[model samples]
Target: MTEKTYPKVGGRSAKITLVLLVIVYIFNFVDRQILSVLAEDIKADLN
Candidate 1:
């Protein structure tokens, strides 16, 4: 006898997930860029 799995998880299409991930990534990149731009000034003052 073979066992069968029941009850599927709520599914989202791959495309939608990819789109959301990309948007979040872009926001993260923008934040990182701003920090990167200011990094030198902060470092110079810390030491």
Candidate 2:
């Protein structure tokens, strides 16, 4: 049988990845909120 090794958690790469994910999530949330707030105005303009 062979043993498989996995990368360590909380490493530098992991921290960087986590930070990037959080940033993307924040931007996505803001974008959705803005669209929701302006939906009515956008619809009225388009119609």
Candidate 3:
């Protein structure tokens, strides 16, 4: 029988990438929330 090799996981780069992605997602979520809250004001200002 031959031995099978598997790909490595849980590296430093992977951790950093995950953290950055989470930060970006958090910011995007907050931005949408703020926009929604100000939607009426924005519409009035644009007119």
Taking the candidates one at a time, how many backbone clashes does each contain? 0, 0, 0
lDDT agreement with native, every candidate:
0.91, 0.96, 0.98
Regions of candidate 3 where Cα sits further than 4 Å from its true position: 1-7
Ranking by TM-score: 3, 2, 1
RMSD for each of the candidates: 4.9, 3.8, 1.8
Per-residue accuracy of model 2 over 15-35 as CA lDDT, tens digit each:
999999999999999999999
Model 1 C-alpha lDDT per residue in residues 1-47, reported as the tens digit of each score? 99999987546786788889999999999999999999999899999
Candidate 2 runs further than 4 Å off: 1-8
Cand. 1 Cα-lDDT: 0.91
Which tens-of-lDDT digit does each residue in 1-47 have in candidate 3? 99999999889999999999999999999999999999999999999
On lDDT, the leading prediction is 3
Question: What 10-residue stretch in candidate 2 is worst by lDDT?
Answer: 6-15
TM-score of each: 0.51, 0.77, 0.81
Ranking by lDDT: 3, 2, 1
How displaced is residue 7 in candidate 1, in Å? 18
Error of model 1, residue 3, in angstroms: 27
